[model samples]
Target: MLTEINFDGIVGPSHNYAGLSVGNLASTRNFGRTSRPRDAALQGLAKMRLCLDLGLAQGWFMPQDRPNQAWLGRMGTDMSLATAELRYAAMSASSMWAANAATVSPGADTADGLCHLTPANLVTMPHRSHEWTGTLAQLRLAFANSASFAVHEPVPAPFGDEGAANHMRLCSAHGQPGLEVFVYGLQGGSFPARQHRQASAAVARLHRLPAERTILTQQSEEAIAAGAFHNDVVAVANENVLFTHEQAFADREGLYAELREKLPQVVILEVPTSAVSLADAIASYLFNAQLVTRPGGGMALILPGEAKATPSVWNWLQTLLSGNGPIRELHVADLRESMANGGGPACLRLRVVADPATVDPRFLASADRITRVEEVVRKHWPEEIAPDDLARPGLWNAVASARMRLLDALGLAEL
Candidate 1:
């Protein structure tokens, strides 16, 4: 049976409060504040351990090589001449949000019986644009068995991709053939629309997904304008259940009708507009919560602490829990460091549907490994980083040294 394994990105030593993301309110609001990279990495590691303790498969993706000298070289810019923004962009720990790692089509959904992965070319933001190459290399090394996996290079530029954060699969079971939903934003208004129709179509075609099982739906412009930079900010799916806001799509009725017609087993849970306004939805990030099937066969909503703080969302959540539904439980994870930068628990991971035995052992999580990672983070990670600190004289060496310690501890120094 295919298993959904969560590969969480280990927060990097360069994690800082730069407020680089344009549409993310939290990021903007928290700009110039002091960030605790140590706490951030520790919290992320704790979440991974929690998942593992709960009998879920957990893996890890390391941060991209920061203070990226190679990328700086391409622009003919060096530290001596680089501005604070330029340095921060290169050293951005944004790669800790691994949901944007790649678009994955499980073996069950492909024509060749091989799982396919395509690294995203996040051309929408300069800070994110340099991530694809490193992400591809990691995917290749992790899922390199050609007999069972196919990791494709990113789609050409001009066709921007934001990876699985904008895609979801709904199947009867993990091993079964599922329907793939590609959410594309037609317009961003003042903001940048990250996912492109051309890129989504290219990935679908490259994966050899059956035309009848694939669907492309346009994300509502209102959602994008309201800081739903990626579709996950407003909608998400797990198994056959789709949990979304009423304003999440361009044509909600048509999309549901199509899903019903094409995949009769699909179950949709749409939060009404009156219950929670789009603003609250984006602020609370209720849709970005992780919906996972528990060990007892019921599903739980693993929400961030922000959801509990929002009155409207909390009230709605209580009502949702009172009802007889598949989602019967809630688990709150305090990912405040990540949440401050517009990333919740869901944003920190990339899901891969595969058998645990099939994946590389090094990527897999265990109690011993988790403890070791935590120890390394505590020992070497920076306790506080501010925007101005990005340009500090020895900041690059400190970040590099801390990262090396983490890589060595995780046995991922080769990466």
Candidate 2:
């Protein structure tokens, strides 16, 4: 019963393009280091708007962060300027619906909540709660309730290095009757050299979730290739297990073909050829795809990638949602640098509960049709604030200025 869902976004800074960030193998600059201000602003704007739209449609969006931000910085990090970038994006998303009078609940009020994983906060492999405080605040405003924040315990050190933790992969939330499946790998430290038995034991105690739900896939010893793996087969939806074929690792053409052949029922998107390694491949998938299940259906399929090179995947998506399913596309030509920095549409958003009364169906259209929250402000505000204005200090200054202008234009008095 696995059903395919398609989601598409133009490559921009906001959408994390894993292919670009995986070690210059693909020859793209890191997003943070890009000199083009326009591209950055566009990517940022597109991503923030996209997150809002997707959150409205799916009722949830999860954003992950880790402590390795510092390490990544030292090791040539060029993606997000700060964890606050993600936070800011989430705030913009909720505020858009709120300002537009859309029916959307804040994360704080929902039974299911968004998880922000951070380093130093590790108790579980990915360190799932550094930004909990800020995340909670956004949820509260969106949902007006405190039920939204779910701070998972820190991932154990033995499970993986900071990179591995950041790459925490989502496995099938279904299967094994009441068990949640999660697959992660060990990237740095002695942990990768040792078997993850200790890490498994630690996860069992921390989350109170079953240990069987956790699957650890170790990095390969050879030249690291994207999506390469050994025997470690973990279920994704119900019966689908993601495995790596050796030949696929050796031959990109073969890997692409195999993915198409194996995932016919689902959409198989080839991460742009620009993408480099398994880690980048997985990150690209997590940052862009969503798990959408229709009411009454028990299975789901990962949506295919939208890059033109992956025509089969795109066609499959079009075919799947051709009829009744709602589809929205957002084009963010500006985020090229951000994707280079590492993050896609999903990484830039934080999902909250939905409010049926305020939800706008048009907002659910693809990126091309949906009006960006920033663009709305620019168009409706009484005064013009150039994108360069964002570079100034006093972060809320621009936001407050824009808000006042918007309210004035609407002829509404300040509350």
Considering every candidate listed, which one attains the maximal lDDT? 1
Tens-digit per-residue lDDT, 16-56, candidate 2: 22122222222233323323323444444554444344442
lDDT of each: 0.89, 0.30
What's the C-alpha lDDT at position 29 in model 2?
36
lDDT tens per residue, model 1, 13-124: 9999888888888899999999999999998998888787667889999878888889998999976579878888988999999999999999999999999999999998
Give all candidate RMSDs, comma-separated: 1.0, 11.3
- TM-score of predicted structure 1: 0.98
